[model samples]
Target: MSTATQVPELSVRVRDRLARRHPGALIGELTVLPGGHSGLTYSVTAGDHRYVVKAVPPGQRPVGRNDVLRQARVLGALAGAVEQVPVPGVVAVDETQPAWFAMDFAVGEAVEPVLDEPEVPAATARARMLEIASVLRRLHATDTRTPGLDAPEPLDAAGELERWSRTLHAVPPELRPGGEELLARLAADVPGGMPPVLLHGDFRLGNVLCDGERAVAVVDWEIWSVGDPRIDLGWFLLFADHRNFPQLGHAVPGLPSEAELLDAYLGDRPALPAMDWFRALGRMKMAAIMGHNLRRHREGKHHDPDQERLPPTIAAMIRTARDILG
Candidate 1:
C-alpha cells in the first residue's frame, strides 16, 4: 500500500458500520495518522467529538471483514484489567469500509523514534520510565484471561532457545550470520525463568508517549500478549539500555539510570550477569521481524521508510549481538 495518494478516504463499509452502531454521528478530526506496522489510523471528529479510526493492513484483510472489530473487542476485554498506558475506547468498530474501525482518540504525543530537533531531555525520560516500570509491574500482576494471549510457560533456557531459534530462522538466510551464534550462547545463559507474567509482544520505547518526560500513555496492541514479563523486560533492556545506546540516554534525560530502573523492576538487586544477552535477544528478534516485514516491501507489496530500513539495521543488529555476546 502506497501513501502516494490522499490515502483513499474511509470506504462506505466503515461509514455504514458507524451509522448503525453510532446512529447520529459524523467523523471529526478525520485525517490519516502517521506510523504503525499493521494498520492505518485516522484522526476523526464527529459532532463536537474526536475519534481514532483504525484498520488492518491493506493486504492481509481477513475473511468476513473482522480485524477492526476484533481489535476493538480485544482491547475492550482488556479494559481496566491490566496496567497499560491507556487506549481510546471503542466508538463503533466497522468492517464494511475496507477493513477499518473507530475509537475515541487518546490524547498525547507518541514518544517513539524521537520527537524532533529540539529534542526531549533524558532525566525527564527517566522519571517517565519509572512510571512505565510501575505500569508493567501492574500488567505482570494481572490475572485477566485474554484469549489473544497463549498460556505462560517457564522462560527457562530451553524455552528461550526454542523461541529465539524460530525467531532467528524467521530472518532471511542472507541475514542470518552471527545471529545464530549469539542465540546459541544466549540459549545456555538463562534468567532462571523469573515468575511468569504477561508479555507485550512488541514492547519498545517507540510504543510509548510522553508528556514532557513522563510516559502518559502506552499504545500499540496488535501483539499485546501473555507470557513472562521478561520478554517485555528483555526488550526494554535491549532497546533502552542507555549504556549500549548512550545517544538515546543522553538524548532523553528524564530517563532514569538503568540501574535505578532495573532495581525498581526487580524491587531489589538484579541477579543476571549479562544484560547484553537479553539485549542481543531483543536486537535479534527485531532484525528477524524486520527481515520478514521487508520482503513485503521489496516484493512491491508494500512501501514505507520504516519498513525499508530493515535490511541494513538487521545487519547492524547481528553485528551488535555478536560483539555483545562475545
Candidate 2:
C-alpha cells in the first residue's frame, strides 16, 4: 500500500496501542516524518507527551532492513549505556499488527543541514567534525556484553564480501554484473583480521541529531552489528568523499578532509592500516543496497520517489568502488 493509504491506518493502530499503555491519553497531530528510504516514521502527540513512532509497512516483511523491533531493542540496550551520546528512551513497542515502536522524539535537527550551510564558519565546521569523531569513538569503545542485547554475528572480509554478494545477486539483472565483479575483486583481496567492535552500521551526519555543534542523539539503529570498527569509519569517509557522491561528502565547506577525519579518529593509535580496503567495501556495500531498493521500486514493492535517482547513483558508486579497488 502507498503512504497515502497507510498513514490513517497507522494512526489508528498507534492510538489504540498507546492508549492501552497510557489510559486517558489522547493522540493529536500525527504527521509523517520524511527523508528515510526505509520504514514509516510518524510524529505523534499523546496528551502532553510527544513521540516518534516507526513501523514496517503493511504486508511487507523487509529482509535485512528496517526491522523496527530490532531497532527498539538496540535503543533500549543503549539507553543508559553510553554517557557521551544520547539515545532516545523507549516509550513502547508492539510486535503484533504491522510491527511498530515508539521513542521520545529527539529535539534537534539532522547534522546534514549544518554541514551543508555555507555561512557557517570554517572553525565551527571543523569542530563539528571533531565532535562527530569523538562520539563515534565513544560508541565503538562501549562494552557490548549487556544482557538482552542481540549480538551481531561476527564478520570478516570474506564473510562481508559473501553477504553483500548475496544482496547483489538479488538486485535487478542490469546491476548484477558490476556487483558480482566488485564482490569478486573484494573477495580476492580481502583484508586480514582486525578486532571486532559494536558497529552503528549506517553512521553518518544524517543519522545524527545535533543541537548547535553538539550531537544530542544518534538515531536509527536497524543495522547495528558487530564488525570491524573501521567499517563505520570507512562509511563515514565515503559519505564525505566528493568523488563518490558530490551531493554528499565534499559539498560542505570547512569540513575536514577524509585523511584529517581519519587522523582525528586514530588519535594516538598507530594506524588504521586496512582502511582503504574497507572504504572500497563500504562503497560497494552501499551500491548493492541501493540496487536492491531499485529492484524493489521496479517490482512495486516499495514506493519512494527518491528511488528514481538510485539507478545512476548506484552506477556512480560502483564506478567509485572500482577506482578505489584499483
Q: TM-score for all predictions?
A: 0.72, 0.80
Tens-digit lDDT track for model 1 on 179-296?
7676767776765555556555665556766666566556676655555566677676554544343222224444555566666676654555556666677777766766777766
The TM-score that candidate 1 achieves is 0.72
Q: Which residue pairs of candidate 2 clash?
A: 240-249
Candidate 1 C-alpha error for residue 76, in Å: 1.6
Question: What are the clash counts of all predictions, listed in order?
Answer: 25, 1
Give, for candidate 2, the lowest lDDT window spanning 10 residues. 111-120
Output the TM-score of candidate 2: 0.80
